[model samples]
Target: METKIQTGPVSTKAQMQTVPKKKFKVKSLLGYAAFVGPALLFFLVIQILPFLMGLYYSFTSWNGVSSAVEWVGLENYLKIFTNDPAFFNSFIFTTKFMFAAVIISNVIGFAFALMLNAALKTKNVLRTVFFLPNVIGGLLLGFIWQFIFVKGFASLGNMTGLEFFKMPWLGDETTAFWGIVIVFAWQTSGYMMVIYIAALQGVDTSLLEAAKMDGASAWTLLTKIIVPLILPAFTICLFLTISMAFKIFDLNISLTGGGPFNSTQSVAINIYQEAFQNNRYGLGTAKSILFFVVVAIFTTVQVMMTKKREVEA
Candidate 1:
């Protein structure tokens, strides 16, 4: 007569709450610290400490020999802004070189990537050959190219009887500027090509085939489909080229030595001259700090603009 009912335990809101937060285990934290502590310590000591010292020195008037380092407030900065004509010229030359190098390198690199992306018998070999230049240090590459421009060009000119190579490459200002640009492009384009090639390989062949089947022209396909998909590569390549071109030093130094009346001088050369060459470390540090700011601004603007385009794409 009596009916027995069996029922499962009712789940409450408390039972459905999130799992308890992980406890702060000192052992786990110590393990993580053991893994990351060395790199962080080295970075702080090597990079951050020097940077802090440089910041302090920028406002001083230390000749780098005497123990006397007088704080000159903004005097160093003001002098740089007003009295440093050579530095200004160097800045101008560097800016011009940067624009030329960035544009030419990216264009050539992208073209090389496209060409290599095509199925070819010697693609791998060609890729290695193209990238070989980038493996060499800029200083060595500069010295090598310097010889080519000075001796090699003259010899070839004599053999071919061509007036083009006979002209002074590193002697004249305009030619010297273009000479550095040429070298920079030659050295840097291969690196960008590698990046672009990787990006191109990641592109979906199916989408490209479908677009082709829909009667899309090559140009349309490249601009509409390919470029949009691989925009991140463009962003990375542009940033690298811009920074490299801006901070150009060893190449300019070895190739031209900022010679023929400081015509080919770059900001790095200017800073170096002010510091070690001229024994004006404080002023040099000031110039360096300002140069860093300008570079940071330029690169930041470029990345922001390109990233915006990437989002739109």
Candidate 2:
């Protein structure tokens, strides 16, 4: 009995160790929360909340001004599908614009990237010059180009006696479509050039030297060696240009005001008019949700395809 009474608190040390570990875990959690808490809260409040609200609003018949929100179920979506020619026209215009703008911008951008990637004295200056257009605000750029189309080009045409500059740049549907494409490509190409330049710099020079030693032609080197390695850049630039072209608003709005009739109206412009101008808030939200789905599908597919190419590369 006396020996039994001499038994120590056997689990005391183990309990002490566990206390510190629990404290450490709490501290680590606090650290994570300290770093990520504010940003998470801000994102939830700003982006996620609004999106959820829009999703709910899409099913309602609430005009922007009215306090009484009527739940109209799928009526807004039905109207968009059946009765909305303008919206469809806007979508068609946007799709066409996306193709043109993406192709032109990426081509011009890749060309600029190739040109500037080479060692030259004036390369830096030319880089700055090309990139300057991107620095200008879209609305401002649109206005400036609008003036050029109307006044500056007209003056130039008179001076040069060239019919090329004398054509209506933003009047007819075909010309207006091309006009937006030109402005978009000009504004976007420089940015793409910068991206491509960065990718080009990362390429292995030793491989390039070996390719040259193997008697590969310049075109062969570019097409085989250069392009494949920088496929990621193509993916990024194409994605950027596609999305930007699809959602073109400020430039088109300021440049042509969707004009000469709504021939050049973008999906964004149509959504804006439907929601705010026409006060069909529900219908507008529905259109936005639908457009969002379409865009998400496109961008997701593009990213997946590009990622597969990246893995293959």
Candidate 3:
């Protein structure tokens, strides 16, 4: 029998010919560009360009209307740090509000989630009712609550003879601070509740049942098991509440007008007033840049810390 030998070069050439290398398809590239180009262009034009301009303006002394924008390097920043007491006060108020709002909203939201997680007849309706406030715009919510605080509370106080309701909710500084806190918590808790509910639903039913079988009390299960498993939800809720509280403008403006001596003025309102009201565009831009840095630092730290906890859990 004659052995048929296959030549290596011939076999290699045949294999190479059988499998063709793919060329970069201009059609596919163009298709992708068509899909993504408009959004990218819009973002550059609307966000990135404006941010760059604002950064440049921060170093200049440009009152919004003036044709003369003199370079005043570091002067705006120096003024904010050294002389701007109102801006500092706003920062302090914003910090206080952030803590209060985050805690209260998360607590209430988590509680609502737990309650709704149980088999209930009215869960759907209750969820809708709770989330209704979130759908209302912040400005509208502020105005509505302003009326409620100014008029409705007084009416309820008269009918019920309750001193708590009768107090000037938006007139006094302390009350105004707490008043904003209440409205913030009320408006935000439902949204946080929705997030918590989604997280809660993702918890393994078997694990919960196993814990119950092991005689884990509700509080113990919550603290030891449920909370640990859903730490990501906490992180998200905290981030949202922190950002909202820090950037609180419309609510503060409409509700109290940062009144009772500017005690409730938020950093956002301060920036707006500096830029628009005072026409100190350079100073406002400087403050805004500082504000952005502070917010970035805070959210970054919070996310890092919470992410560490999440991993450990």
The best candidate by lDDT is: 1
TM-score of each prediction: 0.91, 0.94, 0.91
lDDT of 2 by residue, 1-313 (tens): 3555423565776788899999999999999899999999999999999999999999999888989999999999999999999999999999999988898899999999999999989999999999999999999999999999999989999999999899899898898889999999999999999999999999999999999999999999999999999999989988888788888999999999998799999999999999999998988999999999998888889989998998887
Clashing pairs in 1: none
Residue range with the least summed lDDT across 10 consecutive positions in model 2 = 1-10
Q: Which TM-score value belongs to model 1?
A: 0.91
How many pairs of residues collide in each model? 0, 0, 0
Evaluated with TM-score, which candidate comes out highest?
2
User: Once model 2 is optimally superposed onto the true structure by TM-score, how far is the C-alpha of residue 106 displaced, in angstroms?
Assistant: 1.1
lDDT of each: 0.94, 0.93, 0.93
Instruction: After superposing candidate 1 on the true structure, give the runs of residues whose Cα lies further than 4 Å from its correct spot.
Output: 1-28
Candidate 1 per-residue lDDT, tens place, 1-313, comes to: 9997544333443444423323346666787899888988999999999989998999999998999999999999999989989999999999999999999999999999999999999999999999999999999999999999999999999999999899899999999999999999999999999999999999999999999999999999999999999999999999999999989999999999998899999999999999998999999999999999999999999999999999999
How would you order the candidates by lDDT, starting with the best?
Answer: 1, 3, 2
Clashing pairs for model 2 are none
